[model samples]
Target: MSIDSIADAIEADAGEPIPGLREGLEEMRAGRSGRRYTPEQLLVRSARSTLGLSQQAFADLIRTPVATLRDWEQGRFTPPGAALRLMEIAVRHPEVVRDAAA
Candidate 1:
């Protein structure tokens, strides 16, 4: 279809209800479906949040590059075993990690 025709059609359907969109939204609101993080992602994000540090600060504290930390948090890549262990310790004993970093 022509661009103008496509635009007109889009405008025409602006008020039309998308099939199952409402149901999907309701399911997400009720905690039935949404972006679910992997355990590793949760660990990395939780460790940073628990320590109240920004990504850069957390990366510095962990002695990893910020990009690598972002990759771990975004699930683009899994952290190495050592990093995982450190984050696990951070989660359980944030004070210890903080003191050690100091």
Candidate 2:
């Protein structure tokens, strides 16, 4: 396809009043485009990456064990009601997690 044809196709596929196109374009042009991750998400992803740990290893670090972590990540099982509270607290203040583990 010609350049104009390709551009038009892209615009059509993007759909609906340009959506966040303007904000995305501005961020790109300014070289400051990125995403925001929650602290919990960041901590979990970082621990997995930093230690070259599998899901199992990640579970071990958080003291939840491999199978339970897998269940949590996969949504197969909800952690115990209490564990969820602890997780939220640990996500907010990871040092508390370390101290508790110690």
Candidate 3:
């Protein structure tokens, strides 16, 4: 007859108990969490750090110039169209990058 009754009827038809609805509601509650960085960004950082390379050295590894790497890191310049795509690919496929380099 009412909304609550209608919900109960639907739950009954579905053969599901609604008693744990509170748990579902609690699960829906928002929680604090940090935002994640993009794969390309993380890869750039990791590649540089892992190789113990400066921006210039990292740039060389990625087949770009030092200034470009610096710009990418500092947000002063984007990696350029194709360059950005390459960075994304490298990020997603680190082993590929390494194998290619070797």
Candidate 4:
């Protein structure tokens, strides 16, 4: 929906009870609400974290530029198929990536 339509809907429902709004708010207040990440972002981040490596280190391990890794993690660009597969391997077996890096 357009921003104008969304604003109009909000104005119309100003005093109306919004379904699940209260529950969602409560979840946030309880610190249970989590930020969402795209699959590419998650994959890159997960792989890095799984290996306990910093972004630069992870990028080096993968033979990718740090800037490109950052872009992938930030969802600015999707990683190539080979990179994705390598990251998948890293996530599943971080030791392999670490050993290879050594």
Candidate 5:
């Protein structure tokens, strides 16, 4: 849809507060969005995002269990040595260590 179409849909939201947001959202759905990040390098969330992978996919890629990946991401447990090293690689060179399909 064009920006004008998104604008027309905006008012159709029945007086919602963020009608102007529709255009940006449409752009995002078209793969034309930008993201800002906080530099929390040691966090598992950061590692997974660096590789542009979902949590489950990142776990599978790194040969770690999903539950363990969750624990590390949620800060419930420390990442083990192997997991830590893998995350380090993700942090340093995500495109290098990450697979194309992942």
Candidate 6:
């Protein structure tokens, strides 16, 4: 489609507004971001990144099996419930986790 035609279509749709966006904004205005994430939503690599550790080092520090840690990082498998909980804890308190692991 031509640029002008696309612009016209977008302008027309703009009047309708996106559903729920206003409600979300109001929730945020009321101090609730409405953001929620389960531990399973966290990636293994991200947890390690927050701690500033390499894969092998992170696995060793956490005492997680290297292969299992790799599997999680590679998406070959998601961390199990217990592992996910640990990852959440690690992300939230990297120093404590690191010290305790040590």
TM-score of each: 0.68, 0.44, 0.48, 0.64, 0.53, 0.56
lDDT of 5 by residue, 7-48 (tens): 667756656546447667777878986654323325568789
Write model 2 residue lDDT over 64-85, tens digit each, in one string.
7787776565555656756666
Is 3 or 5 the stronger prediction by lDDT? 5
Best by lDDT: 1
Q: 95, model 6: CA deviation in Å?
A: 1.5
Q: Which stretches of candidate 4 lie over 4 Å from their true place?
A: 1-36
C-alpha lDDT of all candidate models, in order:
0.86, 0.62, 0.65, 0.83, 0.71, 0.74
Ranking by TM-score: 1, 4, 6, 5, 3, 2
How close to the true structure is residue 86 of candidate 5, measured as C-alpha lDDT?
70
Residue 66, model 6, lDDT: 88
Q: After the best TM-score superposition of candidate 4, give how far the Cα of residue 57 lies from its true spot, in angstroms.
A: 1.0
Task: Order the candidate numbers by lDDT, best to worst.
Answer: 1, 4, 6, 5, 3, 2
Which is the leading candidate under TM-score? 1
Model 3 bad stretches (over 4 Å): 1-53
TM-score (C-alpha) between model 1 and the true structure: 0.68
Q: List the residue pairs that clash in candidate 4.
A: none
- What lDDT tens digits, residue by residue, belong to model 6 across residues 1-102? 554454456657797545565555567667886655444545576789999989899889878788988877766677877888888788888888878976
Deviation in angstroms for 81 in model 2?
A: 0.8
After superposition, which runs of candidate 1 have C-alpha atoms over 4 Å from their true positions?
Answer: 1-33
In candidate 3, residue 25 scores what lDDT? 44
* RMSD of model 2 against the true structure: 10.3
TM-score-wise, the better of 2 and 3 is: 3
Candidate 2: lDDT of 20?
58
Q: Score candidate 4 by lDDT.
A: 0.83
Q: What is candidate 2's local distance difference test score?
A: 0.62
Q: List ranges where model 6 is wrong by over 4 Å.
A: 1-42
